[model samples]
Target: MAGHAGLTTHVLDTARGRPAAGVRVELFAVEGGERRRVAGAVTNADGRTDAPLIERGSLTPGTFELTFHVAPYFEGFEAAPAVPFLDLVTLRFTVSDASGHYHVPLVMTPWSYSTYRGS
Candidate 1:
């Protein structure tokens, strides 16, 4: 795996117009209808994991999941509603190129969220 494949993520809070720090993120590998967690991390001040969830040379071709804990994050915001609209946001995607980089970015608010595969 000389040209290793890896995965990274970034979280942005649109409501606050800043990075979503302290957010808990989890990575899971899906296989035969069973899900196994691969890694867990907390978003840093820059709204990014301290290290790639899937480090270089470890990624493989398969379906994977990234879960973001949002309710607890919104709880700290005074502008958030009494009952948050989002709790756990999970993005399920497949990695087809084992030698390419995958960057999943999450942009979210209390009521809405979006994600995309970036460079």
Candidate 2:
């Protein structure tokens, strides 16, 4: 379908008050209790992927997952803990409407993280 259906993501480092650049992200499509990787992306300087994880024409109704690799990004900060409290942050969500746009954004720290359905 050539609607606006797509999947996008961004990561913000709340502890450092900046975008968490160079963080690794993996996208997976879940089916029948198995996870199949669909794509991978890396956040840019603006904490956003260069392209949508799922392009407009390619989105569909299904269970999808996004795993953010955060520990290494936090390690660049001076106040980062010796042992990180948060590491791989995985967010699983469902896409019920193929014509809908899904913007999943993450605001994170070394100790905590949060996400929301963005515009």
Candidate 3:
């Protein structure tokens, strides 16, 4: 990892059976009725960001969202539709422990996506 440990994410393009590179990822902090941008990064060749999206000391106990720009990625591919079934794939999760490391990964295709807590 290139960043201080806190929160991380990985993305896989199941449709092509490869790591999703150049995908945009955004992190948001959800506070009550308002959502604020915390951090953002693009995936590398390995389907992972160069740094932790939320660095260690910056994380707190609250709700957060990781939105992946999927539609644009598939647009350049030959098999994807002009208007894909999925565009922005957002994962909303809560962090109850600021001291803990959270790794959330997405395995996705044009029409489907799945995610879970990662090691």
Candidate 4:
């Protein structure tokens, strides 16, 4: 895995105890003191990104943010109420080590969310 450089992310819907499919994920890097979008992907049925957040041979050590657009997802589902608590959720962290696996997992709900580094 070290030889194949890349970054990955996953989102689990704690409210439903399942993968948060069709959730939009945006990857941004803090470059020159500015946040820039480097990549974007949508969560699949397994709550995992359809592709690596950052592709191989493109990984770099820097501060990064993965913004998950969840509000629209909840609003689209009639089962969920029209008014959701969270509009946009962003997880900011550093990719200090580029050679290793970085798994960012998010467990979220309409009212709250949680995330952590996973293997």
Best by TM-score: 1
Clashes of each: 0, 0, 0, 0
- Between which residue pairs do clashes occur in model 4? none
By TM-score, is 2 or 4 better?
Answer: 2
Question: What overall lDDT goes with each candidate model?
Answer: 0.93, 0.91, 0.90, 0.85
> 1-119, model 2: which lDDT tens digit per residue?
34657999999988888998999999999999899999999999999999999888788999998999999888867788888888899999999988888999999989999999887
Ranking by lDDT: 1, 2, 3, 4
- Model 2 steric clash pairs: none
Residue 47 lDDT (model 2): 98
Please identify model 3 stretches exceeding 4 Å from their true place. 1-5
Best by lDDT: 1
Error of 4 at 65 (Å): 0.7
Q: What is the TM-score of each candidate against the true structure?
A: 0.95, 0.94, 0.92, 0.88
How large an RMSD does model 1 have? 1.7
Better of 3 and 4 by lDDT: 3
Model 1: per-residue Cα lDDT over 5-95, one tens digit each? 6999989999999999999999999999999999999999999999999998889999999999999999968888899989999999999
